[model samples]
Target: MPPCTTPNTTELVMIMDVESILHMKEGLGETSYSQNSSLQKKSTEAMKHFIIDSALAAYAFKTPEIFTIADLGCSSGINSLYLAEEIIKAIHERSRQLERLAPEFLVFLNDLPTNDFNAMFLSFPEFNMKFKAGIELQGGSAPSVYLAGIPGSFYSRLFPGNSLDFIYSCYSLHWLSQVPLGLLDSDCKPINKGNMYISNTSPPAVSLAYFKQFQKDFSLFLKSRSVELHFEGRIVILMLGRRTEDHSDKCTTVLWELLDQSLEIMVSQEIIDEEKVDAYNVPFYAPSAKEIKDEVHREGSFVIDCIQAYELSTSTGDPKEDARIISMAIRAIQESMISHHFGEAIIDTLFQIYSGLLSEFMVKEEIKSSHLLVILRKSC
Candidate 1:
């Protein structure tokens, strides 16, 4: 997250063309996100109550006849509809209580341009059937659900002004728009060598660079979203985070450090290129709650309705079985980026190493994952 200059048209082409690399671009046959996404399922379920409650609060006012919603960073999977369905259920319940007609919903499922939109659109039939039945079961009037896939980076403009009533994002936002500049030396050699994210060995400049990038991308996110959302619209963002203010917290640190270790061993055995490892830095970060709140305040468009942090499990008791699933889940989201740099030839080997490393870490005592859930209401 280095200080990035405003890219010119041509530079922007290079800078913004990360869709080819930083996404879960796989289709449905194999290596799909849908197959490896149980962790995300747990993450979503953990946040369910907050999502439902937020919808209730936002709709307690005058519920619109044509309610518009967007799920930003909705990777190609049925999970994209999970929060949306919760919102729909809440709306139905409230409408039933008030003896009113439930409003029709227009949902925009957004992701990086390279995301598996085909898979998402393909799931619509089943989703629609469920949508119809769910409303009926709630004893409320059936509200039509319209689905559209918006392929673009949410860091920039997506929808028109005042177009969205609710915006929901989960397991995203931690992804920076692109890798930070200045991560490489003058010769384009890596500066933050041997680590994908901030590590204890990283220089202070590395963290500063990342911080600045998050600030810039998040500001753009707010500016665009503020314009797209109706007054009093609500958004809920759930992302992997850290409980402690320290950037060097161990809970968030172990995975990457172990990956670096595995890579180092591979380098010694000449199984992978050392220079490639040095040049690679992930476009992800686990920002502190203060970081999120500061950006929300600075953006000046949204009022914070609620902010809660939860500790999630990095273990599920079945260590050996959970290890493979968790590793594939990480690989599914990150394979594009890893393969682009490390080559697909080493992917299987690299993930095997990662899985072993992850298993070793998960079995340790009392590890808690820090997750932050923030709900915001667009100002009048």
Candidate 2:
């Protein structure tokens, strides 16, 4: 386990698998997938308006003393720095509006056991120095904000009850530990070609499996949040999925195609056995709004503040621009593979195919997809 210091929680020893760490490292560096700078930037901006500000208001921690934020799946990168800055700005505005002094902030950035905590903390030094003016950041006499990395499952309690004021996770949670075993046949054969996992030709079983796991995890997620959050806590989750529900035929989107093409290249190169590829599925599931709402309602603890999905506006740019966003999505997949799943050897092959396929998709007809962002408040 890796060493982690959470001021208000027990020390969590890092227990990430060595293979998984290597996979995460390789995946993040891949050109098409981990390389999407635009998506990262857009996501950062959206988070400010929808999550940071919304969570603070819901928690009623508007005073400087009341500003504390946590990013649940905070993979090591510049995203943490962006989150820190947004939180600080929010705290400042709230302080001035209420005429209260700025308070100290304790930002807890958490991820799975294998994530890069050292890198996460390394991204914090600049933010730390930037906030050194001693302007009360959270509501304390001296405005100081401390950053720490915590590695653990999001479904487990990692903080004292009512300790956090805000929480956010992006492009995560779609992944499950492993595809449910039942999807395959008695002979242990995939009922359909890898479609049961998450492709254009997805099987109902695949969707059901993904939903069940999501519900189970989300149930645990809500319970974990309930235990750690005070009444009126706020949570923001950004999940990936298709925008339209009316399509009759099963078809893989450009994003999925890029990954598929990469996997194909690996098969051609004998990096992975053709049989192994067919037998395996990417432990992921993209859910619809209704599915998400049902799960949240079933948990029965939070009020759904808002839910919206639309085609990415930036994706409409020139051919090069559209290709860039697809590349970003691929990078996200790469990060997942290396950071969590541990598939280092296939990284190079994965990117080679991904870059080629994504460019092809850019020139195709219209592609519109939606991401669901939900803001939830714990109902007392």
Candidate 3:
């Protein structure tokens, strides 16, 4: 028999086609479920703003058949469905003023291969019923909405050129598909066996490493969006970022450092590997305004419709509750780490470290004010 051939990254990327990526987001085994009342409330409220803003922005497009929307990185949660409803209402109201036909919508629910689409599909029936009921109660035609799960990095694919009218991604992106190899060595060996970045404290070199990677990835994302978006399309990118008094360090990055220190204690106790600890990176990056501005300018595609930043407090008093939120918050980050390293054992240990740190951090101080919202529009 011919010598066995191991698959490389290129081959793996092919296998990870859109469908495979969707399955991954559906996650392994049964879909894990949770109800984050706080997150749900905040997310719903923020989404309303996006809906209204997007509707207003749609005026620039000025056509009923062209009205469309997509939720990039729409993981297995009720949020996407919620956004769909809000968008429909907002657009319908906007349409009335323009003397336009009731606009039909094409909504794309997207995420990675390792998400929980099954759970989201399971919830669709209820979503439809609720949406239809709401339309009837309002004495309006139920807007035609088509939902599809588009898998793969939102930075990539997302949609074909000029195919989308509006795009939204909440609490996602900022996840570099892979850690920067430069952070490791000339040999290109992975440093932390696949981590968010060596520790959350984000020492100078490591923090810079993450920023560079994000800038590169985000630049590509902007280029992709430029090509994929129609003239005057709108995109709402809402996620977590940090606020800081000192301008030297990126605010969101500083919060990551605090989280790192919390886990360093575990590293000292041998609960986690000190080397692996420093080698990882988070799926999310708390990007600075400067960084975001520079990237957008470099891409030269999107017009800065708006880039408002807000400081939101995310904290839970109880230890168990804190652990759950921390785990969920860092799920994508950790998964990115694991996929790069190629091991399940490390995943188990990372969770152990995360649990310990989350608990300690809860009593020690606070991990709030690292959340933000960013909205952009494709330049005419």
Candidate 4:
């Protein structure tokens, strides 16, 4: 864990234990990530080609007896299973086409300790039966798929050196290990007051602080993966990103801005303290393509095989319905953090205000989040 400190104070403050608190809303309820994660599923579906291509290329490189692949930040949901199934099916098809025995797969699903692994695992029996039956119907033998769970942050080492053959993460890497340090001033006051993330109103230092944190976290991630990945192993990452170099792009920051407004409403109604809102900051960053390239170059571990950007329009053309969907999606991701900081009692009210605000905003403007897909090969 890294220490965060104020410039004027000699005392060092440790970042909060994010792994203990950060997780998607559990179970299959309406508010759970399993129900509200269609946005993530959409991103995964859109990037299926890159994922399959990378997987096949990796298999072709080394036909190992046991193909070990891990999905970092594999949140508990159908989408997680969907990704795993896609990779397994693709590899199975490739082996059949080549008329070679399919390698047994060692699939590791990883996430924070707080993730609901039980719920995810409960669905596995059905998933396995369906997958195997589909393969048999195609007149091919199903490759043995061994599933295991790894609970930890990807910023640290989770696997033995030279163990992983392929890695995939979707809509997860944008989250920093913790909130950036230096967001508070020398006086120990929040510098990014009233904003959960970088916005136009935020000072330049706020953006720099976020970028610095990202660089440190991302570099650590690359270094850890570089050690774990076998030679020429590949990693495919799909994450929230920005189209421009600017960190405060409206496309990336609008969601946060609306949430900030929702918080402001609660503060005005005396439901929560203004100071608490000021001190709270989201532990996430949407990096640009250039920032990723620079970090990979600085880390000197992986060669970028492909990097592409695409936009996902979050609007469904109905302001009210879109607001509801978007609000639930954001709430599914942020409820745990917000509840931890502000209390669980305010969860319903906060997102209600958020949904109303989003409704109005959508009526005036469309919302789109930029996503970056990058495939990297371990080098040196």
Superposed model 2: Cα runs more than 4 Å off: 1-37, 59-66, 133-142, 244-252, 265-272, 313-325, 328-332, 335-345
lDDT of 2 by residue, 1-380 (tens): 33222211100111222224322332345443224445655755765678766755753543436566788876665565676677676666666677777676778888777776776666566666655544454543435677777777786788888787777777666655444444554444555463324555766665565567667767788888876765677888887654555221123244665566667677787776665555445555566777778878988888889877644544566766676556555565455543233265665556656666766766775455466788888786
Q: Candidate 4's residue-wise lDDT over 196-288, tens digit each?
A: 899999999999989999999999999999999999999999999999998889889999999999999999999999988887888899999
Q: Residues 1-380, candidate 3, lDDT per residue (tens digit)?
A: 43223333532342334233322223333212233333644764855775567756765466757577777767665465777677777777767767677777777777776677677778877887888788779777776777777766766766888888788777666555654434443343344432343443334555666667778789878888788878888877776554542323443543355446645655676756666555444434567666777788888877776665676555655766776665654543344444443345455555566666667766766655555556777875
Per-candidate clash tally = 3, 25, 24, 0
RMSD of 4: 2.8
Of 1 and 2, the candidate ranking higher by TM-score = 1
TM-score of 4: 0.96
| Worst 10-residue lDDT window, candidate 4 | 6-15
Instruction: Compute each candidate's TM-score over C-alphas.
Output: 0.92, 0.81, 0.78, 0.96
Off by over 4 Å in 1: 1-16, 137-140, 186-188
Question: What is the Å distance of residue 181 in model 4 from its true position?
Answer: 0.8
Query: RMSD of candidate 2 to the true fold?
Result: 7.9
- Give the Cα lDDT of each candidate: 0.80, 0.61, 0.61, 0.90
Model 3 worst lDDT run, 10 consecutive residues = 22-31
Point out where model 3 deviates above 4 Å: 1-44, 97-99, 185-203, 244-275, 316-324, 331-353
Model 4 gets an lDDT of 0.90
